[model samples]
Structure formats: structure tokens, C-alpha cells
Target: MVVIEQEPEEPTRPSSPAAEEQAAAAAGGEAVRPSSSAAPEEAAAAAASGEASRAAEEEEEAFEDALTDEQLREKARSQANDAKAEGNKLFGAGQYEEALSQYEMALQIAAELESSEDIRAACHSNRAVCFLKLGKHDETIKECTKALELNPTYLKALLRRAEAHEKLEHYDEAIADMKKAIEVDPSNQQATRSLFRLEPLAAEKREKMKEEMIAKLKDLGNSVLGRFGMSVDNFKAVKDPNTGSYSVQFQK
Candidate 1:
């Protein structure tokens, strides 16, 4: 099962002309001296423009520098939440790729927010859902693992990761993840059902693997024995039921 989180609406930041002007000024680099052929009025206007641009840049920089750490963090959280909310909307619209990009943006912004682990984890989990929808099972597992790293008890991440593992035929890993999810939320029927379903699959896979290994070993034994005019059929492996151990016996 895949789960996406919807972030609460946060206050939007007001557009600042100063910030836009600062960007334009930076991009312009060294201001071009009003063409030497320009009029006196034009030169004066250019000079005024440069001074205004510098004043805006200084003002913006000062405003940024004056922000306390907590305020800065709050701003980052709001920005991250905005990105996450956009991703959720894109996901709901069935645009998984676009949603993935927004989640990536959220993660990048939230990465340095020490108190925003929940946001980080939710973004990662949302990205995992995108991957899952896109049939990128490996990427889904990676994203879910990242979410789980940030919040180990994240049930959605565990369940989504288990689903990814199952898609890749990694029954044991799927079962383990489902078990962890169940541990994290004992009342989760989904996890309990998943665990029940995965257990048989894991057991079947293990048995199949064991049988394949035994067959390969037999082939190897036969190859070596053939050189001595013998076959693997000349030996028997008997199991001691009490100790669950095997005993190799020579046979005619």
C-alpha cells in the first residue's frame, strides 16, 4: 500500500520587488557605464538606477541577516511544506513524475531544518509513492529506506517498502518490513494481513532456493565422482529427525 501526506496550508510569502531587483542586479554584474554617446539626463538616470539597485540589495541582505535562527527555520519549514503540498496535488492528479520533482524540492529545502524531521520523512515517503506508481520498485525501496531512516517507526514507509520488495521477488525482505510495520502499529490490519500473505511466499521461496542449491551440489558431486567411475547415487544423506542433522552414508 502507498500513502501520501497532505500538508496543512501555510502562510504564503509575499513577493518582494527588492529580491527581484537584487537578482536582476546580480545578473547584470558590473553595470555598463551609460554609453559614452548618451545624453546627460540618461547618464543621471542610469546612475540613479544603479544606486537604487544597490540599496535594494543591501536592504535585502540586511533583512536576511537580521532573521533569527528560529525564524529562519520557520521560513524553511513553510517553504518545504509548500513544496510538499504541491507534490501531493500533483500525485492526486496522477502526475507521478511531476509529483516526484516537487517532493525532491521539499526534501532539499527541509534537509537542513533540524526540527523538521516529520516533513523530511513525509517528503521521502511521498517520493516513494511516486516511484511505486511509476513501477520503479528499486527507487521506491530506496526512498522508503530514506524515510525510515529519518523516522524509523514510519508505518507508511515500511509498508510501501515491503510492497516494493515484494514486486522485486524479495520475499524475505518484504516479510521483514511487514513485520516491522506490524511492530510499529500493532492495530494495523494491513500490516497483519501483509505479514500473513508474505510468510508463505517467503517460506516457498526459501524452499525453492534450498532445492536449487541441493541440485547444484548433486551435479557438482556427480562430476567429481564420474572421474572415479562412480556416481552420487552411491551415497545417501539421512536426516536425524531428533537433531535435525544429516548423516552421509555410503551405499552400493
Candidate 2:
């Protein structure tokens, strides 16, 4: 008889770690190890990202701390001064539209400031001049009104509103504003001249209104007198210009 040796066969179902290990070893493989560089690279990336975030926050805080309220106001005033200077130059050159732009820029800066009321008033007054040049009477009046509200003694604003009122046929309002302007500055020759000029116009308007009232009253009187065979034309009131008195007469 010949002697023969046979190899052991694999188990149909694994029962333990030894069996699994043997199985893996039989398949010519081993357990994996942690990566050598991946963990370090990941950690370095996280640290860099955190540092960048912190740096951004610090930069924002520094920026905020750099400018206090007073400092910002000072900066705004300085810029407004420059804009006003530029606007003055443009206005002197008769470039009204361009001057208006510079004045508007000054106003924008002035609005952001805390202590530039005079500057704001000046900007509005200058804009009123621009609107006047542009033939925008209503806009001029509105701008001057804003300026006057800021500085009630603004002579320019008073004069401009008076002029606008005159143009719009508001004679009484024009005279009132002119009187105020004169009252505010007694030595203002322009206001005095304007007042003198407006007085005659106001007088004429008043006389015309009186005449219109008399005419309407006469018409109503005539309607009533028609029932009695008489008319308002039969009655007359004559004024004595010297004494400023009137005398009534009736026709026979």
C-alpha cells in the first residue's frame, strides 16, 4: 500500500478571531495602519483657518476703535469745507448746475456731522441761489425755507422767499417777509430797497380789491333797487382824497 498525506480544508462557517485571522493571512493581507501625514495636515489646516478668522475680527475691531464720534464729525466738517469752496468757485464762474452739485455734496457730508448747523444752512442757501438761476422759483423758495428754519436770521433766505412770493403774486406775504428781513437787519440796504418797491404794489392791490368789493355790493344793491324802480347808479359815494373821507349822494 502507498502512503498519501492530505491538506486541511477551510471551515464552512467562521467561529472565532483565530479563524478570521487565519483566513486573512491565507488571503495574503493584513490590518491597515493610521496615515502618517493626513492627521497632521488636517490639524495644520484647522489651525490656519482659525487664525485667519481671528485676524479678520481683530482688523474690524481696530477699524471701529480708530474713529470716534468727534473725529468723524471733524472729518466731515473738513470735507464739507472743501466742497463749499469748490461750490463757491463754480458759482462765481456762473456754472450754476455744477455749483449745485458741489453744494449738494457738502450738504450730504454736513448731514452726517453732529455740529455743522451753520454749514448745513449755508449749503441750503447756496442751493437756493442755484435754483433761482435755473428758473425754479418754487424750488428756490423751498430751499430758502429750509435754510431759514435752520437759522432764522438768515437774511439771504428771507430775501429769497420774499422774491419767490412776489413772483407768485403773493404780495402780502412778500411784504411781510421783506419787513421781517428788514427787522432782522436794520442796516440791510437791499431789504430796505425791496420794501420800498413792494409798498406801492401792495397799495395798488389793496385799492383794486376795494374797488372789486364795491362793485359787487353795487350789483347786489341794483338787484334789490330794481323792484322799486331805482338802481344802484342813482347812488354815489365820493371820496375826498385830501381828507381820506367819503360822502354819500343820491340822484333825484
> In terms of lDDT, which candidate is strongest?
1
TM-score of 1: 0.70
Q: Give the C-alpha lDDT of model 1.
A: 0.88
Residue pairs with clashing backbones, model 1: none
lDDT of 1 by residue, 151-171 (tens): 999999999999999999999
lDDT of each: 0.88, 0.87
Model 1: residues >4 Å from true position, as ranges?
1-69, 242-247
Instruction: Give the winner by TM-score.
Output: 1
| lDDT at residue 191 of model 1 (Cα atoms) | 85
Candidate 2 collision pairs: none
Tell me the lDDT of candidate 2: 0.87
Backbone clashes in each candidate structure, one number apiece? 0, 0
Q: For model 2, how does the per-residue alpha-carbon lDDT over 72-156 read when each residue is reduced to its tens digit?
A: 7788899999999999999999999999999999999989877688999999999998898888889998999999989999998
